[model samples]
Target: MISNSDISKVIAGVKGQINEQDTSLIVAHLPLLEERLQYLAKSFPSETLHAIAIKTNPHPQMLKHLVGLGYGLEAASIEEVNMAMAAGCAPSKIVFDSPVKTRSEIDCVSGLTDMLVNVNSIGELNRFPSEATCTIGIRVNPQVHTGAPEMFDVSRNESKFGVAISSKQEIINAALAHPVSALHMHSGSQMKDLEVQRGALEALKALADEINATSSGKIHTLDIGGGLPSEPLSDRTRMAEYGAIVHEVFADSQYKLVTEFGQWVHAEAGFALSRIEYVLDESRVFIHLGADFFMRDAYTKARPFALEVWNDTGEFVQGEKSSFDIAGPLCFAGDYLAHGAMLPATTAEGNWLSINGTGANTYALWSRHCSRTVPKCIAFDGVHSSIWSERTTINY
Candidate 1:
């Protein structure tokens, strides 16, 4: 994780570079991202394909950075697949897990040799070309509710994500009918319980065992979707424990392992900087960013982020704190980043705020309702900060 002091140092160096017109900036720490990769390496098997979800931070430079680090990319759409390919990810290293892949899109990815395509539904399985060289699998919703946030959970009985394990016969028959080589399951993100994850994996393994016993073709891969809550930055004990669970479950199995982690890989590596524009009544503080860049945090109560204040001189502000409603400059009333946010009473209009834990699912989900310019991002390495991408305008 990137420390507040680390960010403060970077901001102090680049404070002059930020002009009066710039309202926001995203700081991505390469060292923090590398730490995530290191944790994943320590947790999973050496041969496991740790496919980093591209949706988290689709910055072109970030994509190329991950690919160059020899990490696989998990694409949720055809465009993301193309982006991964363009980033120089090997065809075999890309995993296509889109829920609604059209026939044209199917044909596009099916021709790629050694690609793993996990069909979201049984009906969608028939859309694939009969003699495609790419490997195929069916995504099974283990139906094990992990008590994850409702919006993120896709393993319910009637969920639209995958073939439910309740339809065991249908799922088994589909695997036998198609040239399926793997089975996949993703309960949801922000799931903190390891037992819930264990249950889901056990369910997947049971189905795979049954399929292998009943079918002529054996299941060779197990795509246990990544939903394990990100561990605290202080230590990787949670990851080590999760790895222990994974080893206990599949240590003796022949199936290859693949993990598609989005938030876990990037959540702590990035943070956003927004300029405080107003201090209304010393309670409702308005910042330059709101629903446009913080879609989840503004609209949902689940995605909470931490805030740190820095004065106009770029020095960290620490003193008596007070409760304030941190809001964004959006048209609607619901566009609040946090209500009753505790901050230094000295926080003023010229102060800059760092929104922490925004490295994932923040900017990539940028909304166009307000027509705000997407913030420029700078990658920091504890020593220097460099421009990763320029601010983007929606006009083009």
Candidate 2:
């Protein structure tokens, strides 16, 4: 777990490197990242492919680090597949899962060495080249809503994500028609109930069984889409529990498991620092980072980001605290990152506000509404810090 002291140490070391114009900083703690990976590795079956989701935090160096750690990358688009390749991940270790894959995109990755493509629908599956080298899979929507936040629930009956289980025959037929060897299911994100995930996997297994019961096609892989709830960095028990559930369900099954977790792998491993530009009425504060970098937090207050304060001299501010509304620089009526967030009472202009649990979706979902420049991201490994991405102008 990255504490305030950990962030302070990184800030003290890299304060000189941060640009004045740069209003915010993103810190990626390599140790925490490794902790998540190690936990998953210990919890899951040895044959499991823990494909880290690139859409969560597509920091290039971070991707490289995960690849070097022996984890695969799950790409939602061909561009992400290319990024996974650029990060030194082999094509065999990448999973392309675009719901709206174009013919050009299909043709682009088809020749890659042992790539996995999980088509979302029968129509998309038909877009694949007949003689491509890539292995195919059909994404199945379990249609079991886990009551995850509606915005993140992809398994809704009317969702546009995958082939609904109501069309189980169509999915099974699609697998039979195409060279599909895998079945994928990603119910939603930030779901806390492991049973919900288990239910979804059970549905996936049932479908795979029906498909494999046929003589022509077989489902050798079960791509359980990643929506595992992210625990605090300090709690290392959820992965083991999740692993137990999976093992209990598929102990005798021969299907290979492929997980694509985003927040669970990176959420607590990173933090965001934004300079306070104003302190209005001692109850409202304005920050340099707004909806541009924190789209989900701004749009929905479901994000569980912890807040902290630091003085200009890089010391953690820890005195009496007060409730304050944190507002971003974006010009919108509902651009508040947090309502009544507690912070040091003395927090004022120039003081830095630290947002914990931002290592996952915050920066990756960066919006261009305000045209704010992308901030610099620095990776820290407890010994040294290096810039993962430098702050730059938003190129239109």
Candidate 3:
């Protein structure tokens, strides 16, 4: 977790002073993003291509930086594909992993170097040309439950994510029919438990073996889709163990490995700071609308951030604490950021809170139900701040 102290330090270091009254913005720490890339590099095989999930935080600058760091792009949409290309990421290095692909979208990427396309269902395979030029694969629902939130878990029996592995013959038939060279499975939970991950992969690997046997070594890449838990809250040691589990699973298989990690790489490097709007009571505090900025936090209503309050004068507020209900500026009744969050007794209007550990799935999940434009992001190179958006207008 990037501590409040860390965020405060960065906010303080901005070239110009930040106005607490207008502090609803995100600070992306490039150094932290770089460090995470380095750490993930160590955890995977040297040959593994770490494709950063673009839908997690599709900042063009971040995309370009990751490409420079030898990372690839995992795109879930054609627009994301264009973003990756604009970032100078090689077509081969990008993995098209969308579950819902229109026929035109399938026809567009007919030929690309070393690219992997993991179609969602057996039916989706029909959209591809018979001689399409990229490595194609089918998303296999391993059906290994991760006990994650129902929405996050795609391995459930009724999941609509992938071709049901339950139809054993159909899965085999798809591999024999399509121009596939890989087998991909995404249990789609940020489950950090090593044993649980291994169990899921074991199922996928078995299916891959079955496919490879039928295709005479056609399946050579195993794309274990990424859903590692968020940083700060996620256990790094557990991730290391999970890495070992992956290695152990394919010790004897001669297949190239691909990873598409999103949350673990970007979560720790981002945060949102909101200005205090009102103080309803002794303990009920309200800030700017946050569902339009940090929907993951709003959707789950979990206080995943480490709260730090700073007054309008940029003074860090510290004193005896009390239960503070930090509400959002939305019209809904359940827009509270923290239900009974503990905060400084001095916490009130004219004081801003810096929400930390929000790099991934935050702004990318912003909602505009109230016609709220997403706040501009300030990218920090550890010393200065600059708007990452192209123009000053909030164009949500």
Candidate 4:
């Protein structure tokens, strides 16, 4: 039910001031972020820890905003853990779920009273002395594939994410042996099927039951990790239905539930702006640091940002359209925004391309392949906005 009219207005306003020093930037619509969080809050049970996955869009200002909203933090790295702490996340509100945790990292967080640590591997568990005080949890692979890309699919049989539950006995023994009271399962991100998530949970449920029968204590928590789609313009009724389905599926579960959603909450709230350098031809249009801005999209075509064209004057461009390969300002031939984008034929340098659906993974997953400066991050609140982070960033 959320619209981008406010965001559109902000972008249009920015167009009028293209002469400003930082014209090409991304805006995180604060209102949209709050709206999405509120919607999810209404959808899920109040007690559920709606943990924001730190890796999704770890803009520090966003983290501080989330903390103010009383949302929990699901950190995947030590830096993220520190970011969460810096943003005022209580130790109890943080969940550590990194795939590779070093000895020093483990040692540092071991004493935090209520922080949940989802141990990644059996080998890592072996290194943890029984005396470690943090709440112990084990990441379980349900071994239920969701047909996502191999790189993002963590439940695959050979995934490096967690202990693969090839059999019920395997995960049960691992959980009991490791002194784990919590079970975490992340089937995949941007999953095509909610049913797959339910199936994974069911698989974990059986394992939990096995542990309860064989061990002295019951599983205390269920960390259903991220993968729900967070598109702002998506059908709200259908999304509500999806939320209802999730509630219905887990209504009878005994343990306290936790959901980690990085993209679903933030993806639609963000946008990227790029100044057109020049159009090479009808087939090629070059923009600044092509691969540098959207490394994942330009390289692997994982989440190519949707585009809307506006003139340097900030007016929307509409006319006869032509397919243009949007190229980045990189030396590589493959640094293109889109291979066959149908754009206005009148596109030229100084015109701005407002890239949409960039609130989630676009900047968070970027790589400094060409040593380009990280685009400044802006936050919009109504008609007014401010630069949230202009942290100096570049690579030699």
Q: Model 4, residue 177: what's the lDDT?
A: 76
Tens-digit lDDT string for candidate 4 (39-94): 88777766788889988888888899999999999999999999999999988889
Quantify all predictions' global Cα lDDT against the true fold. 0.86, 0.86, 0.79, 0.77
Residues 261-359, model 1: lDDT tens digits: 888889888988988999989888999888888888778873667789997666899999999998888899999888898999988888899888888
lDDT of 1 at 310: 92
TM-scores of all predicted structures = 0.95, 0.95, 0.92, 0.90
Q: Is candidate 1 or candidate 3 better by TM-score?
A: 1
lDDT of 2 by residue, 286-343 (tens): 9988899889878877475788888766798889999999989999988988888889
Candidate 1 residue-wise lDDT at 169: 94
Task: For candidate 2, report its TM-score.
Answer: 0.95
Candidate 2: lDDT over CA atoms? 0.86
Stretches of candidate 3 off by over 4 Å are: 15-21, 233-236, 312-314, 390-396
lDDT of 3 by residue, 1-396 (tens): 665555666656652644433447777888788888888877777788889999899888889889998899999998998899999999889999887888888888867757788888888888888779988888888877665667788888898888777886898888898787888887775774557778878877888888777678778898998877765433456567667787789888778889999988998888777877777768788887567666766777464578888865456899998898888888887777887778888787666688877788877777876876566678877766777762233464
Q: Which stretches of candidate 2 lie over 4 Å from their true place?
A: 233-236
